[model samples]
Target: MDKIRRWVQEGGTLITLKNASEWAIKQGIVKEKLLIPANGGWADTTATRAASTAPASEGKKTKETASASTPGSRRTDFVNQEHEGTRAIAGSIYRTDVDLTNPIAFGLTDRRLYVFRNGTTFLRPSRNPYATVAQYTATPLVSGYVSKANLKQISNSAAIVVSKVGAGRVVLFADDPNFRHYWHGTARLFTNALLLGPLLNLPEGPATISAEEE
Candidate 1:
């Protein structure tokens, strides 16, 4: 780990995708946060099913009794576990807004690109606005199926983020850019990370830069 950190500090570019990006964040190799779903990851099917199958009359009585007996007991809901499972973004296409001005986006003519997304690994945009080279649009789902809950969570999330680590760089992608060799649009972005990684620059100072200054 120390060697890897040193290499990055000494002008080595480290590119990570999907689960690798998540691992990097966990290892403190990059300063970023994962965008957790509101329900806290996947649904608990067993718990939900148990709650859903209880007698309605008994549930009502229990709730009333609990409310009267315990002043601050949390209320539980009977949710459709099947519906909750739909929140997983199995495989889909989403539109991302690219910062054409950024070197990572060089050779990209369009400001908008469609990318394949197959998992729920969402990334919060960097505090440094300049570091976020690409971000999902307010209405990112371009095609394919995604639950409303998942779509809401993915909206405005970071699709590609690049940060300067000492003299080197670290690029993180929320989804596989080179997925199945069919997503040519995003494949270019992946290539850019390898070819133009050294060109990525951040303002010298705090990690975050306000949009107003730009």
Candidate 2:
């Protein structure tokens, strides 16, 4: 970890895909946050069944019941296993807004890009507005299957983030830019990270130094 940190500090461009980006956030290598669902909304059949079958008490509501009954709390219906599995993106295409002015998006003729996603991972745009090179559109799903819940969460989320670590830079991609070697649309993003990452420069401020230098 220390070696990788030093390398990046000295001027290495680290490009991470999918889980690698999560790992980088966990290791404190980057100052970015993952886009997690409100309550981790995983299906809990056993708990749901237990709560449903439990006898109603005269007083003192159970914690789960109270939470469910609380005002403004989100209520989610229990879905079957097969139906709930759609939360994980099997394979989908989403529309992203690319910053044409940024060097990381250079050579991309279009301001809009269609990217391939096959996982549930999502990234929050950096606090530094300029660091986000690309972001998902308000209604990002272009094609393929994605759960309605996921679609709500993915709306207007960061697709690509670039942060400078000392003289080096780190690029985080929420999904694989090159999937199965057939997604030519987003392949340019991968190439841009390799060729132009070192040249990325953000506004001169403390936000740019939020990664490791702080």
Candidate 3:
């Protein structure tokens, strides 16, 4: 975020797309002409059944830190105090290690894939696009291409609550068949908005334009 903030302040543009539209525009990924289509509504699978589960990419476990014993009830603030000062000043502190014996996998043997988080397995058909968000929420089915866990949320073709993404702001965009176009624009807009805060110095400047094109 800090680095991204600096870039946006200096006049940087973030680009994103769905359906791999931009991916299609480039070579290698799509061997042929790839024209992204308009988005179709979510698909429904009420009668479908849940299929499988997959573990989120594991975070590596660090050596246990013995908690400090207290008089009444022992309380530890290890996770809080450990990375206090340098967390922001330093670069990203990404770690992935699951001290577990086996990582879980959740998915179905279908064309689409759904991803989820908060760590739990699903028992529904998650994919196959629907015509409306109403029909999409009628039942749970695991079916779309999910990444970063929480597969069903974004992958859901039906009624999806996108409130939790990017500071809990609900952004409504018209659908384009490729859907990727919206996400790409959304993701870029978000990155632009956030990084621009410090970069554009909105708190201290005259006026700064956000990702809003108009």
Which candidate comes out best when scored by TM-score? 2
TM-score of 2: 0.75
**Count of steric clashes across candidates, in order:** 0, 0, 47
Sort the candidates on TM-score, descending order: 2, 1, 3
Worst 10 residues of 1 by lDDT: 42-51
Better of 1 and 3 by lDDT: 1
Show model 1 residue runs off by greater than 4 Å. Answer: 38-85, 204-214
- In Å, residue 106's CA in model 1 sits off its true spot by 1.3
- TM-scores of the candidates are 0.74, 0.75, 0.16
RMSD of each: 10.9, 10.3, 22.4
Per-residue CA lDDT of model 3 for 1-214, tens digit only, reads 4454344334443322332222322322211121111132232222111111112322111111112232225655778666444322121111111111111101112222121212121111112121111112322334332233223332322221111112222211112222334433223323433343222211111332324212
Relative to the true structure, candidate 3 has a C-alpha RMSD (angstroms) of 22.4
Is candidate 2 or 3 superior in lDDT?
2
Q: What lDDT tens digits, residue by residue, belong to model 1 across residues 1-214?
A: 7798789988989999998887777666776667653334532122323444579986787678657766236555667446666767789999889999988788888998888999877788788868888999999988899988789878998999886778887899999999999988888888988987778767644566445324
